[model samples]
Target: MINDTIVAPATALVKQAVAIIRLSGPDAYQLINKVFSKQVEKKQNQITFGYIKDDSKVIDQVLIMSFVAPHSFTGEDVIEINCHGGVLVTTQIISLLIKKGARFANPGEFSQRAFLNNKINLIQAEAINDLVNATNETSLKFAMNNLQNSNLHLIKKYRDQLLDIIANIEVNIDYPEYDGVGDVSAEELTEKLVSLKAEITRIIKLSKIGKIINDGINVLILGEPNVGKSSLLNALMQEEKAIVSNEAGTTRDIVEGKINLGPLTLNIIDTAGIRETVNEIEKIGISKAKNEISRADLVLIVIDSSRELSLDTKELLTLTADKQRIIVFNKIDLIDPTKLVLENFKNERIALISTINNNIETLVNQIMESYHFEELTKDDSLVLANLNQISLLEKVENFIKNAYNNIVNNYPVDIVNVDLHSAWYLLGDLIGENYDDNLLNTMFSKYCLGK
Candidate 1:
């Protein structure tokens, strides 16, 4: 058990409505009792209002909440001082706590302590950080699901099944001479391993969707000059983020904006139009556009429906042949509706839009249709967002595959047991059943102080 008391300012140190100073550990109550004027009752989970005093001087009017051991966040005695907001009052209270024998808390120390006390597992601890740093609604939902122990429960289920298999293997090895107990054949073991591998592989594939949700999709906008690329950017962003002009080569640099499409954030980048230019700066911009296209998750190739297709546009179509792209025909307002013929580009995904007339919703819907958002969200709870967790899951899957291979090749049960055991330990580590101090330190160090 952790013996020393810890203290930290749980809220921002700026001028606000209130700031909370938190303390946890053995001396939590004693430290607060020394400075708080209102006598704190021995009652657990009580909130008392009083003035904080340093001898005869009054520091601030404050509200103090207390939690008894084993019921608190850290599974220890905990105190939270809700003082008037500002740097002066909060700092004074913290400094007074330090003088009263409370040491400053390290980053994620409280959460780490909770893990050590068996209050939460590794997945939940990491989820706490994810929840704190979540940028969008989807990310927040993903983190909250994991914090509720959804992933922990799933991992435990898999681990328990593996344990049963391992136990049966042991029974077979130990009771070779017993006639009453039937031996588990190699085929039966392989079947179980295959089923486990399929489940894990499904989760791994789901993690890819989780990653896209965490880090918004990158979209590149490409077209010849003056084909309404900037206009489309403004329309999508609902702001004049990029300067729109009829003049060619107006946008000689990359302009970026973000749009929320049904829980997904599309990081749309508007780059210089791809065309032959004698200007050095335009050439540099064109080069940058090519680089962005190669990295884009989705590419939008804008075309002017009123004008005939140019050689540059044909070349762009060929360049993006292997990429997921949409041929967006802009300036539809200027073209005759019946005169437009899409027979040449019928094989490619196409959208007709008029950016000036604010008719880009169809284009947005087309982009959304390309991703499997509905299916991904159907079972969105407790997605594996951390790279480390995903990597460990991959390792577990590989080990199971290896074990199945050994069984198929008629290897001894003892050899298959090695692979099974390795898989079990790796899954255990994912849930913090076994961990080293260095790994714990690294994981918790990413959290902000007082979390």
Candidate 2:
């Protein structure tokens, strides 16, 4: 049981209509009684209006709510004070609470306490953080689903299957002569393991899609000097984010912008034009552009249709031969339409557009098609947003595979149980059945204070 009371401002410490100051612990009621002037019976889950005072000085007119232990968020006596949303009022109330024997809550202390009190599992706790930081609707949907125990349901099903397998293996090892409990053949065990591995593999693939949903796709704009790279960036963003100029090497740094297409967010980067230059700053910019190219999920190679492809452009084409790229023929409005021959460029992933004329919707549609954005968003699958969770699942998959391999090689069922048991415990770690304090501390440290 927690002994000391903890207090924190649950709302932003800015001027607004109302702000919430939360307190949780054994002394929560006594601490509030010392400051609040309301005389209502301290009933559980009831809100009461009162004036907060510090030695006859009214701090703020507030509404205080009480939550009894075992039914509250943290399974402790909790008090939430809603006061005027001003820096001074919230600060003064928190200060008064601190002086009246309540300590400040650490980051994610409330959620950590909830986990300890069995109110929420580890997956739900992590989902809360995801929901708070979700950047798009798809991410929010996945986080909400996880918070509702969707992932827990799927994981529990797998865990139960593994547990049954282990139990049967144990029974065989302990009572091999018993006629009533028939032996589970090695072939039967391998088949079950194979099915489990397939399910886990499917989940891992879906998690990759989830990662993209949570973190926007990184795209790099790459080409030689004076190829309308900056212009293309401005067009895509529909704003003058990058400085455009007729002069070469005008953009000597990377400029970035983001756009949401359906549920996916495209993080577009406008980089310095790639070319040989004696200018030291231009060389640095080119180097940074190359680095960005290496990290990009998609590369948009802008080509000037008004001019023939230069030797530098050929070299760039050779360099990006292995990357997922779309060849953009910019300045089409300035070029003769009949002279644009398709026989020269063989790449199927190509687009003809003029940023000056504002013809970029087709290019955007091409990008969407390349990644199958619509199909990915339409499906309802359990997508693991956390890297640690995905890593654990991969480990579980590997263990299952190893067990299958051992069974194929005629290893004893008891020996195969070792890997299966390890897999089971790892799954438990994913859902907080088996967890370390250090892991919990690290996970909760990423959350905002008072969460």
Candidate 3:
């Protein structure tokens, strides 16, 4: 409820230079004044320096930022206590506030309140979360645009367009006598629906890239034993994350590490070498490796050029025949450097490198070439968000497609109106025009406690 005050640490409670404790609700100002040495008036956006005390005993010297009603975030009276970042001090301040009548805030309660009060929509609220956890510059740019309602604008635009069409159809159905009034022919209607669906399809394609950026790409390092698979993981991560062993079958489990290659982040998994082994644990590992290969976004088929392509190497190539893969000829340094001058490196899917020399730049660049993003600089709105946002968009796309099909099948214009309305509502769900408590609970629960 907005009437009761909710207080929470607005920053990580670790030992740092400063920690902020946020309070929001109707009685927020009143609750803060109860414990502070100095009184805080209804002065909006003013920072006051004061001492937090238990009667006469000083607790901590702090700075309080006061935000008065209706215009602040959450559209309620708000207060933020900026104190020393000692965990003990922050915890004490919160405890004092609780004793002074402010209850602890739930995870994402601040953003949730902002949504309920119409300060920001669902997509923008989600964008706020993404902004906090953004890994690289590219993702940060997308998150900032999302904060500015980039995705919300698109969803609202689509929703409004559908609503306008629905209203037009209703009017036309009710009044057939009116000449050139709400007059949308069946052909024109189908065309509009088809066009809308096509636009959504394009966005969905871009959204997959957004997902890869926000959630890192899953890359599987696969090969037979002694093929430098572990070496490849270590080289990419630039760390000794996986043990590089000369002994075959040393790595009998999945070893994972993450590395950001500019905009693209790869969750590299070094699995057990895929070869027939009699050992039960090694067999289990081999089975696990195969399972992971199915779900991998990209597979690095590492082959040791130091030795001849054995039957195991050929079988590895045959296995990843249709997968999105890069053929890595490891131990290229073992090849004559004079011969390297004669060979043309034209193939993007094939990389020749020596991890021993730490010369895997060709493989790294090849990865960046795999995803063709022709300068995502134009518009960030095309970038979709998390699974929830993507799934909702999928629903919108489906409804639009169904609407198009109904129109093409010569169904009544009103029948098309039904799907359009469903799509509009789904878009509303994306932008949070219509939603329930359960949706808010599930989405915001993923957010940080202080957020």
Candidate 4:
């Protein structure tokens, strides 16, 4: 609804066959006419061959496409110029558009406009950003599914179900005299609350799976000096990113990499070797290694297969006993693999690997199988994970749980309705069915210009 139109190059600023510059607002066509010298006498969804010029000089021969208001991405008149993708030509055309009264569009402004015009919901809009930022195939699939509108459709279904329950509650409250069949009774109210709880619980379960798929898992590798931690990391990454040496305490900092196991992203962190040392730098590295272990979703306690377990390994086991862990018996090249016995740490997930032998693929498969990463890939479609969505869903889940508890406690239905309403609104916010202007501005501000 701004007075001035905005324009930006829709394509990446790189060498390509053609670049597209998009303009939107009431002055879109006028700005196009000023910069582009061609008869763009085409209707909606039509492209016309044209030549772009600045005053008297020809900039480039181009094709121009125009979309009328309420029919384009921004729900306003929009013009797109398909110019040759040379940096100089594209820059000059943008400068000319500015001279013709067009301002530069902010990051995500076009998507923001689409949201403002009710062309797409907030969840779908967020999916677009997620799709662009996805780093792996799993992340890409989840974002694309969200953009497909199925997640929004499911959310709407849940919202409608909640509303129907709310309407039924009103019927009981407003018309107490109508003792019609299927009317609300104390027992009937309890049953309805139970059913609602089940429905909400189902959605909450899906959110848990969706969250893991969206955010992936963090796995930390911890071990004493020279235990092949870096070697394992290098093997997983399929590159020698970390310094591997026989010298103890070679790695004195955290090294990170991402490995895909089916659909799960393992943000693997190989930390400095944990060891007691007088050297100031190694001591600091050990401290950081412990800290990383404390924050990990999964911890791998790597032990040298040729040597006995040390005090550091024992202490690590005790500290991370409650966390999901894999006891990695590394250096199979130095061990008699046939004589390997796991009875000592029978309760833990174990993997025997040899980075030198490149025999760690079995370990990788074990890690995926132990974590449910394999099962997750069976269904690739999932919603994007973000703090807002996670928080809102947590609120909804807690409220529904509390409502179920109230029913068990024999609280009045009216009191329970408050929690149900809270749950409903929390889910509503995810889809922008309920949101404030400030929230909208903050979310869209993260987008790149011309997105």
Candidate 5:
């Protein structure tokens, strides 16, 4: 259990009318009472008028409310003070709390405590942080849904199912006197194992989609010199973010921007054109372009309609063959309608456009279709895959898979039991049931002072 009290600023640093200073832990109330003098009869759960003081000097008139232990966040007493939000005032109040025996809260300490105190599970705690950092409306909705449907509910369901299977196997082994063979058949046990394994696999697949939503997909624009690559980037961003020119190698560096497409946010990067060059700087630019293409979630292969397909353009197309990409026939306005050949790269995946003509809506739709952004729903729940969480889930899925294989191969129930129990332990680690001191210290230290 956390023995010390922690205090932090619960609101953003932006200029606001008022700021909330939160204190949580066993000594939350004690620290609050030290600096604040109640103006009215104070009762539990009631917000009373008060004036904060420092060494008998009045600071500001404020509203202070006390939440007693076990009913508040962190499962400890929580006290919140609504004080005037000037930076100086908030800093002075936090300094006063520190001097009054309350320690500074870490970057994510408040939520971390909630997790440790069994108030919320690992996923819900993560959701709280995700909601705070959400960049778009879709991301915020997903985080809210995840917080509402606690991860503990999902983990407990899986744990209970596994427990029932284990209990049945134990009864068959120990209570041979009872009608074990007829009551719980080996075939029924194998079926249940297979079903559970499938469910685990499905959840693991969802994590990939969750990762995409939590962190936007990266799309790199690649093409030969002066193929209107920068033009496309500017059009998609709805601004002249990237320099555009008819001269070859005008863009010598990568330009990056974000574009919201449906529920997906695409991080678009405009890279230097790929071509063999004798100039030292141009060669370096070419190398950087290659690297961007390799890491791209989608490659926008741009081709100038006025010029015939060049050797460098062919090379770029071949390089991006393995990546998810869409071909763009740009400068459509310059091309003669009768002379334009549509046979090559002619499909739903190819887009015809002209940045000058302002005809890139088709290209945007193509990107949305390629990434399957339409599939993400407003109501769908999303969970991010941080390193710690991904590792735990991987271990659990692996153990469940092993148990299912053993059961299907007609292996002994005792052998399958080992894998089943391993799965249980992995899930426990996600919710801090199997946490250690190092994990606790590492997690809490990320919080900022006065969090």
Candidate 6:
């Protein structure tokens, strides 16, 4: 148990209606009682109005919310004092708490303490941070589902199944003569393990989609100069964030913007047109554009519809051919939209667009459809957007598959149990049934102060 008390402002230290100073630990009540004029032995979960006085010097009027140990958020005595929102008033209250033996809390210490005390598992703890930082509705829902330990329940289901399998192996090994104990044959074991593998495979696929939904997609707008790349970016963003000029090479640097298409976000970046330029500054911008192309998750290759593809345009298309991209035939208003046909690149993702016509919704819908996480929402499946969680699950899948392969090879059940046991341990790690201190520290360190 933590013996020392810690305190920090739970709200931003700005001009607002109120500011909250939170404390948690064994001495939380003791520290608060020293400064509060109201009685400290109020019923648990009760809030009382009070005044903070420093040896008869009234510091501020406040509201004291109290929670006793083992039931509070951090599994300790926690107190939250809602004081007036003023720089001087908040600072004075914090300083008074410190003088009363309360140390300032570190970043995520509250949630870290909750995990250490078994009040919440690592997955749920992470959900709290993710919830606070979610960028869109989809990302918010993903984090919200995780807060209910949706992924934890899923891991527990797999854990229980593996434990049953391990128990069967133990029975077969120790009670060879006892027919009542029952044992699973190699063929039956293989079937069960294969079913488990298939479930993990589905989870892995969904996690990939969840990553796109949660982290959003990085899109690079690439083409020869004067192909309306900047105009398309503006149309997608619905704002004049990028300069739109008729002259070539007007966009000398990367212009970035974010657009939300309901379920997904596009971090669109417009780069300098890829063409040979004598100007040194334009050359540097072109180099940066090349670097961005390599890092982009999706490339938007714009082509002029009125003119045939130039040799340089064909080369640029070939460069991003292997990448996940959408070939955009821009300036469609200049051509017959009804007769438009991308015959050569029939297998590629193609979109006919006219930024001047404000017909960019087609491209937006295509991007959304490509990264839809509807599977996760339809069955109300739990989300595992965290990369660490997905990686651990993939490891579990590998171990389970290994055990299945062993059974298929007619190996002894004991040999199969070795791999099964390895899987069980990893599944436990996934739910944080067992954890490394350093791993927990690293995960929670990314949180904002007083989280």
User: Highest TM-score, which number?
Assistant: 6
Ranking by lDDT: 1, 2, 6, 3, 4, 5
Residue 65 Cα positional deviation in candidate 4, in Å, after optimal superposition: 2.5
lDDT tens digits, residues 1-451, model 1?
5889999988878999999998999988888889999778757899999999999899999999999989999998999999999899999999998998999999999999999999999988988998898766777777887888855767888898888888888887888787536467777888889899998898887777677667787889999999999999999999999998889999999999987776678899999999998999999999999888787888999999999999999988888888888999999999886799888887888898999999997798888787665555544344777999889999999999999998899888888889999999999999899999998999998998998
Q: What lDDT score belongs to each candidate, Candidate 1 first?
A: 0.88, 0.87, 0.84, 0.80, 0.78, 0.86
Instruction: Tell me the tens digit of each residue's lDDT in model 4 across 203-280.
Output: 555556556556766789999889899998988888998999889999888889987766667788998888778999
Error of 5 at 285 (Å): 1.4
TM-score of each: 0.92, 0.90, 0.92, 0.90, 0.88, 0.93
Model 1 stretches with alpha carbons more than 4 Å out: 178-182, 308-311, 321-324, 336-349, 378-380
Count of backbone clashes for each model?
A: 0, 0, 0, 2, 6, 0
Error of 2 at 289 (Å): 1.7
Candidate 6, residues 1-451, lDDT tens digits: the string is 4778999888888888999999999988888889999778845898999899999999999999999988899999999999999978998999999998999988899999998889988778888998998887788888888887655667788889899999999999989998758677777777888888898889888877787777878999998899999999989888898999899999989999988877677889999998888999889888888888787889998998988888868878888877889888899989898877678788887888899989977777667666655777643576688999889989899999889888888888888889899999998887788899889888988987788
Worst 10 residues of 6 by lDDT: 371-380
Better of 3 and 4 by TM-score: 3
lDDT of model 3 at residue 363?
Answer: 94
Deviation in angstroms for 71 in model 5? 2.8
User: Model 5, stretches more than 4 Å misplaced?
Assistant: 12-15, 39-44, 150-152, 175-190, 259-262, 336-348, 371-382, 447-451
Q: Looking at candidate 5, what is the lDDT of residue 451?
A: 41
lDDT of 2 at 354: 91
User: Model 3 — which ten-residue stretch has the worst lDDT?
Assistant: 339-348
- Displacement of the residue 347 alpha carbon in candidate 5, Å: 7.7
Question: Which pairs of residues have clashing backbones in candidate 1?
Answer: none
Ten contiguous residues with the weakest lDDT in model 2: 372-381
Candidate 5: which pairs clash? 8-450, 106-447, 106-448, 107-447, 107-448, 108-447
Q: How close is candidate 2 to the true structure, as a TM-score?
A: 0.90
Which is the winner by TM-score between candidate 2 and candidate 3?
3
